[model samples]
Target: MNVLKCFNKGQPLPLRIKAADALRYLCSYDPVSQDIRTKITVIMAELLVLSNDNEFDLINEIMDDFVLKYAKELEPFALQLAKNLNIQFLRIAEELMNFSTTQNNDDKVSKEQLDKEYQASSILTNMNTMIITMTSEKDLTYALLGSVEPSIRFVLENCMANFISELMEILESFNYTMKCIVPEAWSIFDLVCESFDNFGFDYVLDYLQYFESIITYSFLEDGNKAGSNNDINAGQKTEEQKTSIKNEESKIISLVVKLLNEDNGENFADEDLVLFLFKLISLLVLKLGCVNF
Candidate 1:
């Protein structure tokens, strides 16, 4: 359809729209013939240019809608594309994240470019979603306790580790904000704790500091939800369930202790370090009360 020419030559709006449509159709439906792949690659490269140039709102808009609708198909495709493309997708993600931090409206691209960026972003977000789903699907808690696949082992491990690192960075930033700007540090602490309560084991504990500090930190009482009438044990636990939970708790606690020791108690100040130590000890004590102990 001479789509590449339209994008390369920066032709009229209708040509660009038609080019995007043709590219999307060929990539999704056409058999992956040599010509198809070349066309798709060219179209993708052109879209990437538009993404960077901040031109052509239609390109971004169409890409955004296409990616969201086809996320399940696009995710692995994007990952493969990341491996093959001259420019790395992760680097783009990092750049986008950086852009998000600086000028609020700085990365404003044309509708065309925005669609392209949205498609790319949807792929990454899908990976995050898939990781969570896989955990529940095959009961990955059982599989990943020791280790997992060779193909995905490092990538999944890295993904989780990176997420944990990012989460910890957020927590630290929140702490700083609380100390400098907010009335109370409790807001930061509580938010961190809530995240812990919700997504505890999803994080891969790689760094000693985060592993020890948050992953292994004692499950502090949630004051806000303390008296809420929600059913904590709606699903009755079997003996196996109890055992699994206890073991998971023990492993997490051990990981934390290891991390804390690795830091030599130097990361935090003396008073805060003592409080952390106290929390660690309390967690150990709580573990001792469990059936496994």
Candidate 2:
């Protein structure tokens, strides 16, 4: 209890670190009670929320090892932990953005700035690792997705282009591993479409290609060519699956048409993008037989 109390924001950093070390050591014992493990996980989550860049490495170690090591015992707190991590990620992202702006204004970088950048990078990597690890657990993934949608949108809309691209890659890996599509997944596509102007053509094209791949994976069957599996096998899709595919196809088509209609020859004028969209719409039409368009 005293060690847990030392995680409070009012505690000195060195004292908190030592206390965290002690807590981690104690939690690792074979004789520790399940109740004590749960309490330790709770305290760790709270400490993460209070942690800053100075505590990045320790927090990363706890997240990467300690959290996962006790994941089963701590399953009940998955959503709470995800929310806390998201809050911490937002804080770190803001720091990174500030560092980016600072770097842009200065002709030469300093040691302090480089150190800060490295710390921010480490935090970002740690958060990514934690996210991927959480997603590997079915219950944890469900809990994580419930709270992570806003963070996804924020990263997509506000972060630097490189970070936005990295986020898309992470989401792609998420989709590939999860296999089933969730509503939150579609929000990523929607945000990409809505923010078309902010991202470059290459990024937009990559997203479209990703969307196309998702369509193929979700809607088509093996041995049949893409868009040629009109008479899908009865075993291939459940009623719910069919409904989901139909809705997502409609949504994608609508987004494409809206982009085309609203384009005043400024954005969406890239020949490659236009050609790709044309091909994608054609594929969707072939699969659906008739889209209301």
Candidate 3:
């Protein structure tokens, strides 16, 4: 509670920063009693409401991480926070996605690279923490999906996609750059997948269309790639470009195959889900020649 005083208008910038950091540390290590959590939420909300741009960003960072760390303690109020801080939260999501294992020409990590990775890791820390809370409350997952901001929804949905699209991007970049995928990031993805799968057919059905959109990326016919000179690439693909596209396609197939191996729809899910998986699997086999049984 003393940390809350650092938000006073007369507080020194350094003091305020230190106080906020100290509170965040305390919040993460200790399970905040419900009463203290309520006070902190109310205080943080007020600070956000009254802050200028500089103060807003600072306080947002503090409260955002707090919410992420004690997500179970704070999630009951996440929707309210999202509503009030929609743009900042969306920007947070965008920043998290903007992280790349893709380095510049020479495969070396620079100061800028380190800073970006730190920023991304910080954001992902909060996100992964929230995902831990979300995994326990299926309804929280749906609530986040219904966020008024589309980017918020994007974060929630993509967080649950078993990292198929995300891991592909990471793997492609990693393979190209001799980079490594963060093991913790992969574990968060796996946890979300396993948590949702525990919902069985209901989870499958609820997210069916969204999953289909991701799966269809590797299934684009030749006609889909055939376009005029006005398109983004502007003209024909070079050999390297063609190889890159093929490599991406292979990544997509590998991702789908991996997902299927984890998802045994026929055994425990609805028959319709089983049939849908079969049909999708058949198309995949026809395109790729075979899949791992």
Most accurate candidate by TM-score: 2
Model 2 poorest 10 in a row by lDDT: 225-234
Between candidates 1 and 2, the one scoring higher on lDDT is: 2
lDDT of 1 by residue, 1-293 (tens): 45556655558756766767665655555453335444443455565555445534455554544444444444434533333221333444455444445634435544434554554444333333333333221222222211211212222233323344433533333222222111122233344344444444344332223323332322223321112122322234466745544444455556446546656546445554455545655655653454222
lDDT of 3: 0.47
Model 2 TM-score? 0.55
Poorest 10 consecutive residues by lDDT, candidate 1: 175-184
TM-score of each: 0.30, 0.55, 0.39
**Per-model lDDT:** 0.40, 0.59, 0.47
Ranking by TM-score: 2, 3, 1
Over 97-128, each residue of candidate 2 has an lDDT whose tens digit, in order, gives 77667665554455555554444444445445
- Which of 2 and 3 is ahead in lDDT? 2
lDDT of 2 at 75: 61
lDDT of 1 at 138: 24
Cα deviation at 186, candidate 2, in Å, is: 1.6
lDDT per residue as tens, model 3, 97-205? 5544454555344554444334333333333334345444444543443443243234446553422333233222221221111222233334434444554344444
